[model samples]
Target: MELILALAIGVLFSSGIWLILRPRSFQVITGFMLLSYAVNLFIFITGKIHINKAPLTLDGVPVDPTRYADPLPQGLVLTAIVIGFATTALYLVVLLGSRGLTGTDHVDGKERDHDE
Candidate 1:
């Protein structure tokens, strides 16, 4: 499971990077979203995977810290997700406005000359 997750993270991260290098504004926005997802997954994975375990210790008795999955990463990921969503929405609005004004989705706000 860990291996599969790692591969997925790698693919997402790489794909995001690849798209980020493109000349299209929409692709760049998508790349940012993918990159954010990859980072969130990585941060979550660092906490380790556990099931049927409590996130906090309720008893005063001594307990092993390792037994509980770290909650910090989960919280961080959640916050990041919210922020990413808002930013993506804002980007889309900006993209739409730019597209309307420039009549092109290219990063440079101009159409390519295909004759070359």
Candidate 2:
């Protein structure tokens, strides 16, 4: 499970980097979003994967809370997700304004000639 998670993060990070290098403004925004998601996953995994472990004890049962996964990372990831969404929305607005002003979606505010 941990290996799979690691590979997933790597894939997301790689894809994000690739997209970031693209010439399109929208692709860059999407790359940022994907990078943020990768970071969130990393943060969440720092708390460790608890299989079949209950975070809260039931009926006053004696279970070590420390045995359960830490909740701090979970909270952090949740907050990051919200912030990422807001930033993505803002980025889209900026992208639209840029496209409108430049009449192009390229990051440099202009489209290149097909020959180039």
Taking every candidate in turn, the Cα RMSD to the unseen true structure, in Å, is 2.1, 2.0
TM-score of 1: 0.85
Candidate 2 per-residue lDDT, tens place, 44-115, comes to: 899898787665557767777776767788889999999999989998999999999999999988888782
| Angstrom error at residue 97, model 2 | 0.7
- Candidate 1 CA-lDDT value: 0.90
- Relative to the true structure, how large is the alpha-carbon lDDT of every model? 0.90, 0.90
Error of 1 at 33 (Å): 1.5
- Candidate 1: clashing residue pairs, number: 0
Residue pairs clashing in model 2 are none
TM-scores of the candidates in the order shown: 0.85, 0.87
Q: Model 1, 1-73: lDDT tens per residue?
A: 8999999999999999999999899999999999999999998888887777667877885888867778898
